[model samples]
Target: MNDSAIDYAAVFQALPGMVALLTPGLVIADVNEEFLRAAGRKREQVVGRLLFDVFPENPNDPAATGMRNLKASLQRVMATGERDAMALQRYDVEDPERPGHWQERYWSPCNAPVLDPGGEVVLLVHRVEEVTELIRARGGRSTGRAQGLEAELYSRARELQELNERLRRAHAREREVALALQEAMLPASRQVGNHRAAVRYRPAVGALNVCGDWYDLVDLVGGHRLGVSVGDVVGHGLAAAGVMGQLRSALSATSRVADGPAQALDVLGRYAHVVDGAESATAVTTFIDFDRHTITYSSAGHPPPVLVHPDGRVEFLDRATDPPLDARPDPIRRPEAGTAFTGGATLALYTDGLVERRREDIDTGLARLADSLRRHRAADPETLADAVLLELLPPGGATDDTALIIVRL
Candidate 1:
């Protein structure tokens, strides 16, 4: 093509990343050569097919979530005519030659909308860069020496992949990690005074969103007390996770120095006002003082924690709950409430995913959660955590992120 007569098709192919052009309906209009090669699919096989139809979730891996997350990102772009940058995703691709085998792949995807003159989206630019090597690099930098080491590591890993993959397929541990990609971002299980603690994190079915929900447990007063919190950042995607991470970190730092949960949250509320994307986020923080035999709690527009008695009775810590973080123009002192607990009682802190459902009242969901806790109150902390999640979550999965922490108080 001459300088004045540019070939748009050639330009699309030369865009330097794995790019796919799709209609607003998600039908693939075209794919750049890089995308076709990286995905190990011919353009003829993918173009004109729906995005999911072209690259469906790997059936062999029950933990495969690429389709759902990508679908959610694309849908968001279509809905808002905005660009969406997805977190690193582990989406396996089927081996074209092998009938049922899959090749593990990871991608950093971004979806953008191409709008018409009327400002309506006419096309969606689904761009992705294969990051399989980078993730497999496992923290290799781009320095001169690091690049060579990364290449050597990549080569060595490739040589051992067949053996490693066989071992991975034989074990369920890898699957567990894949199922909770967001879980790895959260803190691992640790001791909290004399109490036994259990934590479970499940991302939304659609977004697989690191989904703005978070949970934390911090030792206070030299192990005499424990501070725990569950919060939601009011949005989805990487942006929400960034905001959530900052708020969680701030609360973690302040909880130790603050007098109580209310003071900690008060500090966080003011901090939230300055953090981008932190507006209207909600959280519930609690301090369990062993010496006092009491639990002090404060909520910022989040669901109240549930306390299950030795028998079957449940109590909602709702007295001190207030508006969400930064909901007020100026920060005010938050309210705090405390209640004594018996020896065999249980404490539950969870994000809305455990109780909020589509087309139903929140009270109804809370009631359901309470009933489950009541029945499982006799179980131990780990057992109780698993049971509550199993019983309360929908059979398919919750559409929102869930972060649950169970403590045998």
Candidate 2:
């Protein structure tokens, strides 16, 4: 085309949608009014400047990478005298009004080399289309070719949040219900009549709902003879709680007759084994004879009790760690007789969860609990128990129910 016949400025200014013609080095040869206004610049500011000189911060960002690739593609087109259409791309434009947020942008490039009479490249034409609205609707950056993928992602996230909230509320309600049920099953806060008694129940820390571990202190028919019991069933869900309830009821009913700890556990185990028919199931129980100052406690597969003396010296009572009842139809070899307690001391009875977790073995875990108890010897029962539960149990959940009962005699 002859220079005298061609009207270069008129043709570029007339075309729409952010047109820019560039030199080989990405220097702007010419730009349309629409392109100048959209970039928040004037014709004098952009026409002679390189593209990188305007947006220098994002050299490695995807939009910048796309621009570099377009430059390369343009070189190919210029050599072959071919026109090319680019894949869709994105850009992030800083908004002067919004300090931290950005205005997202989408673009597609049209590039061709301008040829002279010798068929040599003299300039490049870049036609850019802004598709920001379309990009925002389909979700940014990602290709959303599949139908409804964006809406599905949004809907699933919303559903997950709603489910999490419902679970939180349900857990709170379950705790309240478990606490009320446990309170009803427990003896009065203050011991009735001549018996001076205290019962402490600490639910497992991080356990979903209040566990089935509970304590009971009832005045048996024999005068001055109170029945002290700490019990835990094998599991942690509602089933375990149900089992605990049955055991407490049965123990209360039978305590009127049985005077021995071993005998009481035997009776409880016999009842549990028969619950689902056959002797396949098991539950653990411990009964203490709190005959005034003398403490004779027995266990059925439960962790040993700790004796915290008035002098702040703590010791774990030793007993034959037998299998939880239901290892056989017969009751476990009666937990060997425990240490005799003198006056002015606290005895702590707890289920295994208080001292055991999935990460560590039972022996090591129990030793840690004993050491923790001894370290906090001066702290009172409630504080000490709470600290141990918070520190020892796993952060999220408990594999078994934990029950703690502390009594000062």
Candidate 3:
């Protein structure tokens, strides 16, 4: 038969497997009948469109890399002027009968450059073999030596699964013990001098272990003043909790001898430099004198405390003068800031977890916290703490450990 007289389109349609002719830019030029049937697409739907535009990688499947691999193969064919074969890929297609649904399809693809007489690639010829059935069949069948290998693989998988389960159980037990130890180290809420103090500590909901967030209230100068502290070590699990305990104890001891909040933080910074793994902790310490109606506070790389006034006005004491504990051998002494608390005023000291969120900025989270506090300013310390937590945390609960202390004067 004369080549010019032969029907090339008919021959291509009758060919086995799926085949398509694409431009150098990967635009679909022509597709065979088999390709159309395999993709559940008509010629009019795909002939003039980009390959990726017609069939995109499944948005729902994070593991899908078909589009990326196909593009790479096409580029390789164009660059080297040789055929490029790709391993099986899960290139899903849209289901025609079901909108917004996808059908998983696997293919073994090969791309070759169609060169012009001038030795330049004019088009790319892509051929695809549907390998989903073959893969499923091989996975389902086991014979002779294959049976032995399959059995060995199954046995190894079972052993590994059992080992993983045992590890999970062991981790659960450890977490429980760590949480109990953390709770034991925390101080209960009570009245210190003329101020009523309340505290709330919540562990991370999805965490398998505990964290270093903690709060404390200590009487200073023989009950003439009140010292309140909230701090967090820079990690999770037992090690962080141990650091938290040490910091809490050091803060309490330093407050007895130190003249003010700034001096206390300065001493703690010096002490943190000597302790192992205690350098990255953050804390805010405050001294309350009821007779003077004044509260002096200092921050060591921690979130500022929120003060609520009697008239329902809220303010954040955000003057931070030093880095986190142990950040330097001799950290600078943080400057102290003081504010007068009128009757019916409330003060809040909390770790960052109480006001930090993953998607939102720290300032935005702080604003939300301030708003919540203002709304519940008239409530008692315990009730106010509950209301603030309920507003900030999701129904599923917090993802990080949070420590909150509310003092009503």
Candidate 4:
């Protein structure tokens, strides 16, 4: 047999799906027997005719613009030399040979560019799959009750709910993992250059899994200059946790750039003020300069730090002179040096929840904190921090979150 005398019958008989060839203009050049049977048309009727002419009424009738869009997509395929696929398109055509019989047709384009002997684009080949039986099986009939419909429906619904629950658990685990990473990055140990230091942290029990209470000790350029900070984010959960980390990191970075405590807190407050909305709610921050014997602090609705002396006397540090970060355009108020202490001094910074009780007043909580520090004056900063947690925090635990940072001079 000559190569020109192609075995078209063998090709169609062996094909796994329907196939067709069309001109760039959408004129049907050639179609397999499957296409003819599915459309209920003779080869003569469809061949040499425009596809839209044969399938006159578009399936997406109400949205007739779909046909135009589909044509535009086909043009993209031709220009990009890429294959294009289409979903099921349904149709019902009356069969001429079988009177009173109707044919269901569904077509999907499997695009290809046929090349001539010179490798030039000759025609576009679309291996269309006529999934009539599949469409019929998927389509719901007007009548006939399914077997165990209620039980089957219940089983599918339960499966869907189970899948959704698994997704929620996976998302929660991801959040927990992220929070754990942030906690790890926080300052677990305390150090102020050559000076000995210690820290204690206790997460609020009743609060959300994560709290915004965070503290940091940054080693400044000169061993004499150290940065101390304690802050509380507005809310609980991952958003607050993330923002707390950002503010802490920003404070650390800003301290390196600024020369003094007041300048550092001022810079951080200015930047935080721009983080408006829920993200930039408020944070109370203080910077201590051990080398120059000066203390600069700022508050964003945060509780004031308690000052403990070696003489066993406790006093609240200079009250905040500025609003919390992001409170206003000029929210920052410079903290000034209040008392000059040379021998040994302790500055205890804490979140509001630590010194505010539901049944008791704010002053009562502050008094309790002071008395606890005075009673445990001999213990190290870490032990003192833990003692305060044990004495002040309720047996059931704090309703709100708590964070504390104690620095000694």
Best by TM-score: 3
Lowest-sum lDDT 10-residue window in model 3: 131-140
Give model 2's TM-score versus the native structure.
Answer: 0.56
lDDT of 2 at 245: 77
lDDT of 3 by residue, 1-409 (tens): 8999999889988878899999987899999989998888888999999999998888997656678768867876664566888866667888877868998676889888888764457899999998655433356476777667656654554464456456657877998898688768888889765667889987665444567888888888844688899998877778888888888999999998888999999999888888786868889999988788888899988999999999988878876556887777657767888888897899999887777765457988899899999999999899999999898764335557788999998
Which segments of model 2 are wrong by more than 4 Å? 1-144, 165-176, 187-208, 276-292, 310-315, 330-338, 375-380, 383-400
Per-residue lDDT over 1-409 for candidate 4, one digit per residue giving the tens place of the 0 to 100 score? 8867988777755666666677767788888777676566789998999977765544433323324434544554553344667544444444677755545444555677665553334577767665444434444532344434534544554464456456557756966875685567578755665444566555554234566777788777764666777777777766677777777888889878776656777777777765533344455555556766655565555677777888988877656545566666654456644455444677787777688754456887888889998888778777877888888764435556777777767
Residue 221 CA displacement from its true place in model 4, Å: 3.4
Collision pairs in model 1: none
In lDDT terms, how accurate is model 4? 0.64
TM-score of each: 0.58, 0.56, 0.64, 0.55
Give stretches of model 4 more than 4 Å off. Answer: 1-179, 206-209, 276-280, 291-294, 331-333
lDDT of 1 by residue, 28-107 (tens): 99999998888888878999998887677899876555776688788767655678898667678888878688888877
Error of 1 at 36 (Å): 33
- Backbone clashes (count) for model 1: 0
State each model's CA lDDT, in order: 0.82, 0.62, 0.81, 0.64
Q: Model 3: how far is 113 from its true place, Å? A: 41
Ten residues in a row with the worst lDDT in model 1? Answer: 170-179
Where's the lowest-lDDT run of ten residues in candidate 2?
277-286
What ranking of all candidate models by TM-score puts the best one first?
Answer: 3, 1, 2, 4
Q: Tell me how candidate 2 scores on lDDT.
A: 0.62
